[model samples]
Target: MLRTTEQKRKYIQATRSQNYQASLKLEGITTTAQTTQQSKAEILQKYKKYSQPES
Candidate 1:
């Protein structure tokens, strides 16, 4: 329903702003692990192993 250019820009900005509100989200993740000496997949897999329920 956004017919005007200004309205479209406002709608797009509003939608993108919602994505930036990470503190309100449930599962917020960070890329700080990527700066570490460990590889990306290795760190993720380690967390994945700990997150799972034991058999």
Candidate 2:
């Protein structure tokens, strides 16, 4: 089944949050500010790549 745009966005957000949380947990860091910031940047880059309009 195909996912709607909202579903896709939610999925991405959830996955990114999960990954950041896991990273922080594995590193035994209580604060994930830096990691979360970096993850957001990476996620934006990926979205930009895939969301670019076709020529």
Candidate 3:
């Protein structure tokens, strides 16, 4: 049986998350559910600022 496109995408996302968590664990950093709407917005804003070029 073959997986659908959405299923493949989900599998890849899960794999990436697992890999990231494992790397953090190896570094003695535990994962936490500390992300809130404000934090997400702040992160996005920081990225937006970082992605802009000098004018």
Which candidate wins on TM-score? 3
lDDT of model number 3? 0.81
Query: Candidate 1 on 1-55: residue-level lDDT in tens?
Result: 9999999999998777566555435466543312246888999999999999998
lDDT of 2 by residue, 3-54 (tens): 7999888888989988888898898878635543457788889889999999
Clashing pairs in model 3? none
- Whole-model lDDT, candidate 1? 0.73
Q: How much does each candidate deviate from the true structure in C-alpha RMSD?
A: 9.5, 11.6, 6.0
Candidate with top lDDT is: 3
Rank order (by TM-score, best first): 3, 2, 1
Candidate 1 weakest ten by summed lDDT: 26-35
- Candidate 3, 1-55: lDDT as tens digits: 4379988888888789788888998999987845234777788998999999999
lDDT of each: 0.73, 0.80, 0.81
Candidate 1, pairs of clashing residues: none
Model 1 CA deviation exceeding 4 Å by range: 23-55
